[model samples]
Target: MTVALMWEARASDGRGEELLAWARAQEFPREPLRRETLRAPGDRVLVITWWDAPYDAELPELPEPDGELLTRAVHRWRFESVGDG
Candidate 1:
């Protein structure tokens, strides 16, 4: 099975671009099968990485950026593929 890791963060006030840039500059501990970055209306950034691992396997994740760049702490979620979708 494959697991997908999603990491999200909201930037403080007018720092959306800065937060996005910071996220773009980060490196995952292990290479993922697929990776994507997304931006939302409320200065939010989302990163999704797909890995070839069991659902309960431990995986490395992107560390939170400095507090000054964020409006709140980062959020994360993990999901495993159900079937050939």
Candidate 2:
């Protein structure tokens, strides 16, 4: 079975560029990892990422920022095998 791991994060205003840059620089060696940014409907900036494997497997540690403007952050994942509905 295949699974997709998703991470969602939000940062305060004026901090989107920095946060996005830092995220882009991450070195997670997992296969088929994709990152995307979106504006939160209510507040803060949102970032989402998808990885082409189960979330429980080994993954590169994300770089930690000295200071972050993230007021709210969340992580979730879904699993689906190839050719599965």
Question: Of the candidates shown, which would achieve the greatest lDDT relative to the real structure?
Answer: 1
RMSD of each: 1.0, 3.7
State every prediction's TM-score relative to the real structure: 0.94, 0.55
Alpha carbon lDDT at 71, candidate 1: 90
Report lDDT (Cα) of residue 58, candidate 2. Answer: 54
Across residues 1-60, which tens digit of lDDT does each residue of candidate 1 receive? 899999999999989999999999999777999999999988999999999999999998
The ten-residue window of minimal lDDT in model 2 covers: 40-49
**After superposition, candidate 2 runs with Cα above 4 Å error:** 33-56, 60-66, 81-85
How big is the RMSD of model 1?
1.0
Q: Model 1 segments beyond 4 Å from truth?
A: none
Q: Each candidate's lDDT (Cα)?
A: 0.93, 0.53
The best candidate by TM-score is 1
**Residue by residue across 1-85, what tens digits does model 2's lDDT show?**
3444445556566676666666666655654555565555433334455555564655443434456556555444454546636
